[model samples]
Target chain A: MTEFIPPGTRFHPLPSPFPMKRGGALVGAHVAFETWGELNAARDNAVLIVTGLSPDAHAAANEGNPEAGWWEPMLGPGKPIDTDRWFVVCVNSLGSCKGSTGPASMNPSTGALYRLDFPDLSVEDGADAAASVVRGLGITRLACLIGNSMGGMTALSLLQRHPGIAHAHINISGAPRALPFSIAIRSLQREAIRLDPNWNHGQYDEVTYPESGMRMARKLGVITYRSALEWDGRFGRVRLESDRPDEEPFGLEFQVESYLEGHARRFVRRFDPNCYLYLSRSMDWFDLGPDGLRQIHVDKVLAIGVHTDILFPLQQQQEIADGLREGGADATFLPLESPQGHDAFLVDIARFGPAVAGFLATL
Target chain B: MTEFIPPGTRFHPLPSPFPMKRGGALVGAHVAFETWGELNAARDNAVLIVTGLSPDAHAAANEGNPEAGWWEPMLGPGKPIDTDRWFVVCVNSLGSCKGSTGPASMNPSTGALYRLDFPDLSVEDGADAAASVVRGLGITRLACLIGNSMGGMTALSLLQRHPGIAHAHINISGAPRALPFSIAIRSLQREAIRLDPNWNHGQYDEVTYPESGMRMARKLGVITYRSALEWDGRFGRVRLESDRPDEEPFGLEFQVESYLEGHARRFVRRFDPNCYLYLSRSMDWFDLGPDGLRQIHVDKVLAIGVHTDILFPLQQQQEIADGLREGGADATFLPLESPQGHDAFLVDIARFGPAVAGFLATL
Candidate 1:
């Protein structure tokens, strides 16, 4: 299983066994993953982790940072997704530039960045691609397939669409199908990117990406990721008069604007425009098996809901558990409380770690 | 009394006791006013009611649309200022256009409007102008001088700089000195107007008013005037989508935007641009009496504070009362609850009117 991989070692790229095609998009995987511990002989000791969107395969921690992956606190040596026990492998999803086949990678067909012509893709393709990695890596079974947010939807797809895959699924703060509000918000983000003049119909090959468009998208996304109360409490009426100290015009507004701008700027640099759109659209279009969950074939499931997660509220988690139960799968549910809103799944480690650790401990 | 001028009745030439000034850039006025009530022959039965910013000489529900000086509910027959009880004179303070001298009036020095060239008007100047009108109208004494918000500050200025010209003073939600937060907010509003491309340094004439800039200014003002909770409760995530039904596009968000737009549109039509800028600046620079109540001047003070007045909290009202008491004046304090906030004097007429009536009855 994946536990055979060294603990301190990170990037674990599993090349595809064969080529993959979806719609007009042809892709071959060079799946980069971050594995914890060693893969057992039967692979039953293995748990597969997947990141949502934008982040790289480094799902555990950076060499120096030691705390990244949006959910680093929940995955560590003694914590949940315990590196000391279960072999965990988190591979960057397909159609992402984080050491995976993506728009930024040269299209084998045109020998250029895929850009808009990369052809539309869905979450099913992402799940299939991930499954291919497990098979190519010689893992016949996964102990648990873990995913959060968009990644959670992919996990569900993997269990139902790909048979004899993972034995158990852990969905943390996600939905079987995208909420209408989520769809609308994502649509707006895409529109904002499309409206940027520099986007050039996704054609400008001068290497100057549509940073403005990306920044706007990030700003729009961050708004939903944060709570209004948090914004009011943190930056209510603060006017940083001398912020741009060197700049002549000292009239600055609330520091919150600067904070938001920072998030927008940073996100634009490390993320690909097309990948974000594709992932968001994938999340938007996601739904369950043929007839609700009865059609899906997962052996067991553990759904983790968070109270303050407006994006994937408690109802979404409950629906997942209910659907799995209806499908004759052993399902459990856990709810966590955190004011960090949707980001709470990534930040509420004190409660989430215990819940994750206890759940995995049983396995 | 203004009551003599019935509703729908327009005063010819608007009684410009304070001539309109057109100093090169704009034309504005210093309007005059009078009320219709029994003078009691002694003239001591007269009370001069004053307004803060933007209001003209018209105070009563005059014979016009019954909505004139923004304090119509408190000035009608048998109301607080009680047109039936006392002779009331509320003049359009100087540096205002409703028959008062301001940037919109023709400059005596030049043939054009004073416009940007209009000297930075002080609240003290506005108060002195009102005092001039009281003297011009041959009123020997005022039974009481009632002011609200900036009007309250203006009243305080009148009582402080001017001697015992008025016997009783009623200041509602007023501050003798402006708060730093208030100043900062006002500064931002002014900056928005000044930054407008069409503003031309505040010299746009030919009826091509800086409507857009003025709208933004009013929008900023409205945001600050009402509590944000009210915004979320009322507008929240409601959108004014494109006219086409079944349009999947996500359009304008937050009902507050539409709310602000509606308000700004109305204000842009009714109010002058320079007047708003000048009034805001005047408020920013406002200060009355000495450092504390120990140096203020007033005989008897009735200070009213509205609970929802976030801009000028209830404590500011308390400060007004305390200052009067320190100045050896008899002081009375009362709090009125209204969701209308700083604009409660205009909106919560039922509650506000009765409170004013009760206070006036005692006075």
Candidate 2:
């Protein structure tokens, strides 16, 4: 499968033979990014936005791309991140198929898709790639680093590896390490994909693209992304208007089932399955240990989370704040009451936006 | 696949032309059951236990069956249910494969496995079947009715349809109706089974079974059965002692994944996938609605749930209690602080046992 890159995505060439965290190197690779607003004369106003698993670097419509990005509500000129005040640059993680070199990308050395041949991708490798991109943009130090979801893990890694790379940091809905429950969910997801005969050991083409596997995985993800309270409020016992005939058993019956099917159908073809497997496993392998946050030398840190997020519970955000505080950073932990769960940071912009903007203002 | 009946299960022949709730009739049908302790001449000391989707009639070892049953810890002589004082009868649900006439059973008219050809099975049908067994045993009324998990749904139906059938009811981790979240989860599970090529519209056999699909469905069920807090407490980030080789990219790496794998493997063949699909869908179709409980005429009701149960959840239990109370029954809602989630009633017997015993003692 070809990489699903969005239009107007910019690339930054990495140094040849870029060493990966888990004992392998990438050759002739590049990181994907998109920027809005301009860096100040001193490049001191630059802000970096690291994203979650599936989002591309096109965070918001800029001069080059006219399409609204995933986080458009919180990233435009007059929005929460406020591009007019902060020169925001969002980079797609290294192991994503969204205009970034990943398992779906063609290997320069062998002129073939990396697929399973790709080296083990760790969260730290993504941090290093983002760091390379920041450096490539000629920014010595960022005003603030913002990470959401998986990117939150990457931000912690970046701060620990490249000390003082940013003046401040905001970690949103991310954990210090992969919890067992989260690991189990992702493991079942991967199992769903691999169990699909169409997956065929990642050699699937568009014709045999493991659609059912991807659909199941995406449905499982959508289930976790939102809260049960929200589900009950939205579709409580609501059957579909056009329920299937009895002959076709297991057909869509409830509004929730239909909603999941529609969501999963839209996602299965849009994202590369191999890239998903790699990124998901990378999160499972991530752990900053107990004292890993003490290595980060940022001036201020804000860890934001929602109470309804079962995947990354509110306590994880508390842990991040407490860890950063122990590191002598002016840290604050803000737990929001949004009922959107793990995906609150993406959809509950009314709540997340103010917290982010307020933190950035303080920074 | 043959029915997986344990030894010493007794069958009660239903009236010929046994009508189902949704529409259809089973000819020469039988309901499976087992008895512990003797019923006094008055028959007022009789107690009935209806079970979840998977459990059989052998709820505990008796003179006929030495093998311990699913609820062995909470049932038997001098145990929580206390067969020493009250005669206990456990009946396998009509649509289950364990010694009951489910999709795996041979159709008397067709001389072939019913499979998908089986009529739509509703929770109400199971209630009617259980009611038949009770009436067959010459018990005009039960001293107490015990329902666990899906059995809770059946119990509610039985109480509503067969008014005054049980003087008291103890609903353990059951809901009045299926919630949207639970429906979505079960829908995905059914989809997993149907998507398997080996399933072949429920034409699977012992040699060509849909093992992978059943494995995925069972794993998903196991994941939801337990709470995230319990998972973290039990398997928190514990890696496997012998991790799989890198050649198998999606192989098990963590203890939680291994646990799910072991669990799914053990379950895939032990139960019929078609029966699982039928029973799962039946729950989705079960909703007693806002006033469904008002039809039940039990003297007292006890609804017990754990705080961490994601599948049935605590609110459902509260709803059951509140609805029963509204129906003029002396009802008590007991929410336990077990981290084991929906399966807590099965594993956390220390808490469940006493509450059950206390309720039965009052009855």
Give the i-RMS of model 2 in Å: 0.8
CAPRI tier for the interface of model 1: incorrect
Tens digit per residue, CA lDDT, model 2, A193-244: 9988899999998898899999999999999888888899999998887666
Residue-level lDDT tens digits of model 2 in B1-363: 444888888999989899988899999889889999989999999989888878888888888889878889988888998988999999989988988788999987899999988999999999999999999999999999989999999999999999889999999999999988899889988888998989999998999999989999998899999989999899988888765633477788898988998999999999999999999999999988778987667899999999999899899999999888889999999999999999999999999999999998897
Query: Per-residue alpha-carbon lDDT of model 1 for B1-363, expressed as tens digits?
Result: 122222443222223333322212222334456565667777787777677676666665565445655566677677766888877776666566565656666676788777766766777766776776676666766888888778888887777767878888888778877654455456545654564556677678646666655665575567546653344345544545743232322223334445665677777756666767777767756765366455766677889887756568777798778767877888987787666667777777887777777766766
Instruction: Please estimate how well model 2 matches the true structure, expressed as its whole-model Cα lDDT.
Output: 0.90
- TM-score to true structure, per model: 0.56, 0.98
Question: Per-residue lDDT for A10 in model 1?
Answer: 36
Runs of candidate 1 with Cα error greater than 4 angstroms are: A1-363, B1-31, B34-36, B63-69, B206-208, B228-256, B326-329
